[model samples]
Target: MKYEKAQEILPQDLINKIQEFMDGGYLYIPKAETNKRSWGDSTGIKKELNNRNNNIYKDFESGMKVDELSNKYYLVENSIRRILREHKKSNK
Candidate 1:
């Protein structure tokens, strides 16, 4: 999200009313529900995590130890285990 000058875009009356209520403040305007994206939709983080988890599964199938995977992926052992468990559950 970017800060846009309300004075430049909004009607003068609306801006005046807003200024009357709060001077020199931030106003949060949310997108319409129809325009909203789900989490990670715009950033590609979801795709990246999926790719990492798939690689984790492949590494485990190739006999990678949990601790080794944790070290290689920079994740904790428990996180690696959880990823493996999630993969298993999803496969079923």
Candidate 2:
């Protein structure tokens, strides 16, 4: 799937809603069904983390070890390893 930046894909209405949340002193965006899915949830940190993990796994499968990739990407090797471990356990 091709990823588009949030500023490009988010409609004006959604942008307004996000601004409202921010203005109201809310650091986290509230989950709301703007279309078929919750906009806030779809663009959240959890989704970003999952995407990073998938990319890491792909690199690992292509002959890059966890430590090497983690060093190159400036990510914590142990954290990436744990994420891979949990992902494997969940798929079992």
Candidate 3:
């Protein structure tokens, strides 16, 4: 099942964290809460994405280049690039 828009479904604290990342030019969500109902039957894809995004943040923070980081994680390179670009723009 498709995930709902973040603001609509995420808890307040999670939403705040997500907003903080977004404000800093990252697009990420936290690991799904176990008690909360998920958008779909827990396929685990969203959680996996969250983990991958977290890894991306860690790598980025360590001074890894987007292309190298994306290659290492097997993720969509454009998404990482966009997140970095947006983050820079938002901070300005």
Best by TM-score: 1
**For candidate 1, what's the RMSD?**
2.0
Best model per lDDT: 1
Question: In candidate 3, which residue ranges exceed 4 Å CA deviation?
Answer: 1-41, 83-92
Q: Which scores better on TM-score, 1 or 2? A: 1
Global local distance difference test of model 3? 0.72
* Model 2 misplacement above 4 A: 1-43
- Which digits, one per residue and each the tens of the lDDT, describe model 1 over residues 1-92? 78999988999999989999998999999999999999998999999999999999999999999999999999999999999999999999
**lDDT ranking of the models:** 1, 2, 3
Clashes of each: 0, 0, 1
Which runs of model 1 end up more than 4 angstroms from their true locations? 17-24
Q: When superposed on Cα atoms, how far off is each prediction in RMSD?
A: 2.0, 10.8, 17.2
Better of 1 and 3 by lDDT: 1
Residue pairs clashing in model 2 are none
**Residue-wise C-alpha lDDT for candidate 2, range 16-42, written one tens digit per residue:** 888765653424434466545644476
Tens-digit per-residue lDDT, 37-67, candidate 3:
6664468887787666767777898999888
- lDDT by candidate, in order shown: 0.96, 0.73, 0.72
